[model samples]
Target: MRILQPHTRPADEAAARRIQDELRARAEPFGPGPERVRTIAGVDVAYAGAAGAADDQLAAAIVVLDAFTLEVVDSAVAVGRAEFPYVPGLFAFRELPTVLDALERLDTVPDLVLCDGHGVAHPRRFGLACHLGVLTGLPTAGVGKTRLVGEHAEPGAAPGDGADLVHEGEVVGRVLRTQRGVKPVYVSAGHRIGLDAACRHVLATAPRYRLPETTRQADALCRQALREAGTESGSPALS
Candidate 1:
């Protein structure tokens, strides 16, 4: 896979914020994205040292899957040290470098990407999914296990039920129930996608689990990659 829009690494929190501010303008939060989606990719990162430590090892993984079958078609992993400090709302800076490396190693470029984090439902409306979508110029969305921003009522117990996730007087995402009676996941548009489409995709990809198959597979792969890199399991800093 090739990156359509490469970006520079931020030297500090200020620079990272500036980058987000600049790129945030390019994100298309309201969209009808990928009508005929055939493939989807899930991206995740795992840590192998104390959080915020410069020496902390990072493992980034991207797993492309058949949209209908949910079978992995291609996958890649990259292991490296964290390049920037861990700052709230700017976690993308800490993981994107290694994630890009892994993306470049992939043999397939997916029709859409699903990040294991927030997107427009972030403090700056530019979380990992938005950042990665803009940089790669790919249609992307986020399906986060935990809320990063916004407030919402609990969705219904049935799968596919959802509620608006509102922030600052605007609907930024959705609280979606992918599995019946399971905890809901946060779904948000990253780039070139809308919240409705994003939620639809998430539900489609997560037929049998609380989390999407893409996320679960990518998460497992990143952890395995970290272990193969000879590091003990460490808590993930972001996703």
Candidate 2:
């Protein structure tokens, strides 16, 4: 696979928004075929604060899965610190270096990637998910526990129900009801797909938990890698 790079900076809402529009223009909506998907990888990152003062010591993790069986097949981890301050909307700036390193070791180019962050549901439509997807040109989806931007009506309690995450009258993403009565996850396309398709893909991956296996495993890998890379200051939640 090829690697790509994007211009990124502090959380400039205006800049992010411009990038979002550009991305939206290039985004190609595709059919949600289970066959189009085979190997899935979940990506997650964690942090251990820096020495003295306050600094982000982050770790990135990726867990690859067989799309058919949803079993984890491979995984990798990387760690780094923020080159700059934690600007509000530009989190990818803080984490991408480590994340990319983790991704480079994969044996298979996943049919899809499940990212633990926002995508088009962002103020600039270029949140961590979008940034990473565009950089890698991978079929990716953002599955966040919270919304970084946009609004949505309460989704239904059923596993398959979801509501649009609207911002400025346009659907940026979705608030998905992954499990009955539980807090819904924020869903969005990072690259090469639409909101509806992103929702479908996320739902398809969720055979059991509120989160898909890819994401669940990615989160686990992040924490585990952190533990393995010892000699740190403040410990982060999980990895």
Candidate 3:
């Protein structure tokens, strides 16, 4: 059964705002987030041709991580031809169908979902992570490789240093220098998690490299799956 309503036509600012508000209101507070968070799933999508639209193609994959030691617990993959067109504020329509289907193939429910997208840091105050989190009613975080919607200074040449991702006088997310000088990931709470907790989780899980363990593993899985599926593109290029 689908948790969110099917998308309707007339995608506009008003419509976007309405959907965002509805999801945000429905989002629940944090619970026992995997006590040890033993399982973390990282999701990534590969696009073929134009994004969205039935003509386009897409592939999604998730790599479950064993949080304690940051190792791959399990992996799942799914692929489908696209059925929607690329839209700025309404990515859910373009990607959610295949993504949800892919997630359904997972062996276990992840303690937390780390998406290679966005969360509340959006013009409508909601992004892909926020949409998926509420739709799945699970805790999710957005890890963008670039600034989506905010202003901040580059952190020091030291890992763990970060600046606030502020927009319109409100701090939407954080520009985290997960690795010194390489690049920063835009960290934001998707749902059922606070900002502080969200950042901390990303940092903690990223014990070895820049991106969190799950994300890196999942990213690799996406590429491998796409290659095995004989597709040209791997995933959405955020960098």
Considering every candidate listed, which one attains the maximal lDDT?
A: 1
Candidate 1 vs candidate 2: the TM-score winner is: 1
CA lDDT of each candidate? Answer: 0.90, 0.75, 0.74
Candidate 3 lDDT for residue 179:
72
lDDT string for model 2 (136-225, tens) is 888777899987778789888899898888988888788898888678889888776667777877887887889988888988888877
Q: For model 3, how does the per-residue alpha-carbon lDDT over 1-239 read when each residue is reduced to its tens digit?
A: 23444434335546655767777676643443445566778888887555646557667888888767777878787777655566666666667767787787777887788888778777766788878888887788888777768789877777778888888998888888777657888988787775667777788788768888878877777667766766446565788
RMSD of candidate 3 to the truth, in angstroms, is 5.6
lDDT of 2: 0.75
**Model 3 residue 22 CA deviation in Å:** 2.3
Residue by residue across 78-154, what tens digits does model 1's lDDT show?
Answer: 99988887877988888888999999999988999999899999999999999999999999998888998889998
Report the Cα lDDT for residue 111, model 1: 92
Query: So what's the TM-score on candidate 1?
Result: 0.94
Task: State the lDDT at 146 in candidate 2.
Answer: 85
